[model samples]
Target chain A: MLRELFNSENSVLYHVGKFVMWQKEIYKKPENWSMYYKEIVRQMYDIGIGSLTIVMIISLFIGAVTAVQFSYQLSGGLIPEYYIGYVVRDMTIIELAATITCLVLAGKVGSNMAAEIGGMRQKEHIDAMEVMGVNTSAYIIMPKIIAAIIVIPLLVSLSAIVGIMGGYLASIATGSVTEADYIKGLRSFFVPYNVLMMYVKAFVFAFILTSVSCYQGYFVKGGSIELGEASTRAVVYSDILILVADFIIALVLTS
Target chain B: MIRVEKIHKSFGEQEVLKGIDFTFETGKTNLIIGKSGAGKTVLLKLLVGLMKPTKGKVWYDKLDFVNLSKEELQSLRMDVGMLFQGNALFDSLTVEENIRFPLDMFSKKMSIDEKQERVNTCLAKVELEGVNHKYPSEISGGMQKRVGIARAIVLNPKYLFCDEPNSGLDPKTAITIDELISNITKEFNITTVINTHDMNSVMEIGENICLLHQGKLAWQGSKEAVLDSSNETLTDFIFASPFLKKLRNAAAG
Candidate 1:
């Protein structure tokens, strides 16, 4: 009879409230600065270097596909050939590079974070740390989130560059655009504001993916099967939230 | 010493610990024994501040644990050390790193050389010397358990909690762990509490015992009291097998 009033924990609003409240725990002063520094370095290496190859691969393919499709669309229209380069560059910078790259990372880095933390939770490592007076939330979650915030933006930038190059190579190789025309298009309508938008989206998506994933793993209970579910949910929720945030960011930033 | 004043814990509709009032004495191996699902783990967690009580207060000496602020709780937790049921050694870290983690995290005044020396000293204490660089998976189960002990005592904590320290070990290793815990507690003069169902642990190093039955304290006393007490719950738990009953009868005769 008394449980229902206090325990509508299943609602989405409840989880959001909990997540918002949990932020305070994550922002507490560290027990030792050097320890957090070391952890941040380790997490930086793992999240940055670990996902580099996959990010580059997906970015290249996305760039190539965008260029090819844009060329085909422009063929029947009065749009100039160089507009392919302009469209690909703006598209990669404003949306594709940030969104797709993070979505991929949501699968790669997000799931990995979930499994690592979930495994620690199952093994009682988190409890052991808690007993030692280390802020498990700060020590565990902050490093990953910080590292992601720093590196994911850098990764998105790289993805943008690689994607542009992919567009160049795909269009020129397929006789869709000449090198001179493509180069001219790349130089045309270049907006520095689009670059800022990319960074904004990168920062937002990075926070979403890492924080959401870490949250899923941190609060996990029960056994191996539950751990697996948490890992999957980390990726799933991260992707969904990324898309939603992308829409909202697009609305706000473009407005 | 840690004292629970009228502690009661419940999970939704089910109450797991019903008014468990007890004090775990300092420098003694205080054991909480019970059958599976009898709430030994729940009680241990409550004592360690991992879980809060549904009602009543947990007193860690002069401090009230239930009402401690976040910073205060963390401050209090620094003096606490625990050996989890699975040892809970960090798999990614080397054995030395695992043991040295608390020191590394909290011991800002210590030099790297001092930290290394302390880690080595703890290893030697656990008789796990020379395996510093090896990960937890590379070591044997008993050795892992010792590494867990080494990690727990790295800070020379004032309060030590062990939850099933002998859950998976063989008899010989279990005895060794029990002796180590007992010695550590006495040497450091720290209040030690153990939650376990291992009878061997109960008879060997259980200077103080707490037997929980269906979330209530069924029996509490010294290790010597187990042999003389005619408590049905304790008897049924200790002499559940006929072989043990026969041995008890023969010894009595």
Candidate 2:
């Protein structure tokens, strides 16, 4: 029991230390920030752009299913048919679009980051950096963090727009809602505070994904199995932490 | 000069280096040689600050490495260069960029042209001209090793550390690497240290040799003395293989 408890506590402390190291690395200027930027852009294209189609398809189906389910349930209620749009827009943007979508993106982006870095670690590229007097954290982790910071907001924005439109199209096609009434309903429920909350969650989710995955990769020991385990754990832990963080933020910000 | 004093390192229950005490002098190829699992690599890592010794100190000239802060360590690292066993070139970087990496890190005031010139100079030193645009994967193993060597010496470091510099090369290429290291050490007059199990290396360019047997200093001497040494263990080690015994015979002849 003590061994198990110690293992758990060690994992917690390891994660906390990893976050501190990542934060410290963010402000340290590397030899060539431009090269780092270009690398980040390349990764952004691979992680963000390449994964866009999958995220879009998932978001679309989710929006359509949510609208159809809501319309079927609320058809006989006092709430008008146009409230479908309100439900779709508000729910997708505030919760599903911002949080659930990010959870999925984290699985893609975060795991890949972990695996790539972990592979480099296994292959001794990070050791090469140390031998060359290049700070591995500054050179390797910075580009990744900066890339996630730049690309995540843009991805969240895209998901929001696509998901809302998917719901809008599904609702109008089913004859359960009209475009004008849906637009009016969406407008009525719109709040600047909700949008601000979405952005905040997006930013935090980005940090959680990049920092955790990079940390898992950074500390990878042993060989191939260890790297795969690190990537798998990175995705699982980041997903759970994103949900927990979202709830806390929702509680604080909604109050 | 690099000095390791009573250095000890352990991994959990297993101790790698018992009490390695040695001094690597300037302007020569100082080699650490031993059988596999004899703590040669661990001692080299301790000397280069790759890993901290569990029970002693490593010093560069007069500065004690154990007492240095992280910032001081970084400063010390700036004046040292290491070529890893695997020729760990960044796969993502091109040859020119790889050579220029150190210059970019430590010399901000250097113009791009000056950096390019330096890169070319280092590349030329390794006889790898016009291959700057190619990625590391595009290069041959020997070429990649040369690129690794170029990057190691690009900074004109006062201290050079190489771990198993010729492990994967053919005999001819290994000889070239050994000769290149000796020439660079002589030309730059830097304190160069190499760790190798390759007896060819021990015979070829080992100006100063430190033999480790199960983590203790077995013997220290020059390459010429290596063949005539009367130490039973050293003789057994040098003549253990037919190829090495033949080479020793040839040297004697």
Candidate 3:
């Protein structure tokens, strides 16, 4: 037991150190500006457009559920009826939109990145590129990170808007609160800093997910079974780290 | 010339390559022939700088590979080309793009027309012209290997490393590939190192052969010498199959 524990601890330390070192390599001066630019554009389209529908569906449902539950809790209370909209707005902006959207993306985008890179590694594509004098780490990974940092925040912002619209539709459709009351609540107690907080969370979560997933894929070994495991680990670790980072960001930024 | 001096490689507690020393001559087809698990792939990886040696040094014409910085290694790699066993063509890119990749990445000053012309020349050299727009999946295995060769030589490298270039191909196609590699090596006068277990390849283009047995250089000779050499390990390996042994006996008789 002691030996296994010690080995596991050492493994974690080794991976963490490798991850940091790999980041340093990934940011090295690119071989060609045009090639990197083209790759970044390709990744942007893939992450942004490829993920739009799923993000829309999940965010809409999450907002509707929050609205309905808040209406139920605030029923016949001393709190104003419009307070449901206010709560939903703040929740979506400060926490739900950025955190939930990113957690979901961590699963979707992270696993895809891992699988694609792992497949390349398995096929010796990475080796082929390495022999061609291309820095495989930077060529394969830097674009994904840059694209995610640029696009995920945009996706989160879109999710926020769609989610608020979902809350509005749900509340007014169910007749739990009048349309006028919800709109008034949304306009009240609106802090601009909450939007900043959401963007901050989005940027940090995007970085964590892309970098971790790329790292998992870049060093993958063995056959199909190992590749699958790496993909799963990418999603699982990215999700866990996003949640942990969310808590820390909330503590540090909100306080 | 590529020279490995007392190179050793280990993974954890297991040592894969044990003090291997050999020089691959320029303008010749150098073959590393070995059985599976004899560290052929490990040695190839070390030569390409994909994996570092646990001990000793690799020299590319007196530039010590083991001690080079990252930038220096990258610069060295610019003159290197490799063809993998699996071809390793990007599935998303068409044949033209695949061949054009090196030129695109490293030669920014070259115009698009010049790049296209160079790509065309490489494709023509491989007898793979008119298939440039097709993706890798759209092509047959032999054609894919040709495309791989086109990509490897697109930049006109000084050193070429091919790992199992004839694997999964028909005997005729394998011979054709061997002849193609031999022609390219002679035409360019570049050092070509091939890691293969195929006796056919050894007989065809093994100008300087190094046979490995359990991570040691078991035999080193020319293709003609491989047939007549009295090295036990080489004889045992070459005649491991009954069919080859019978052929050897018939030839001897």
State which candidate has the highest DockQ: 3
**Candidate 1 chain A weakest lDDT stretch, 10 residues:** A1-10
What would the per-residue lDDT of candidate 2 be over residues B1-253, giving only the tens digit for each residue? 9888898999889998888789899999999988899999888877776788899888899999888987888888877888888887888889989888888877878899999998998888888899999999998889998999999998888998898999889999999999888988999999999999888898899889999998888999999999779987788777889987888789989
lDDT of 2 by residue, A70-94 (tens): 9999888998888888888888888
- Order of all candidates by DockQ, from best down to worst? 3, 1, 2
TM-score of each: 0.97, 0.93, 0.97
In model 1, pairs of residues that clash are none
Per-residue alpha-carbon lDDT of model 1 for A53-101, expressed as tens digits? 9999889988999999999999979999999889989999999999999
Candidate 3's displacement at residue A111, Å, is 0.4
| Cα error of candidate 1 at position B191, Å | 1.5
lDDT of 3: 0.93
Candidate structures ordered by lDDT, highest first: 3, 1, 2
Give stretches of model 1 more than 4 Å off: A1-6
The CAPRI-style docking tier of model 3 reads high
> For residues B70-154, what per-residue lDDT tens digits would candidate 3 score against the true structure?
7788788888989999999999999999999999999999999999999999998888878989999999899999999999998
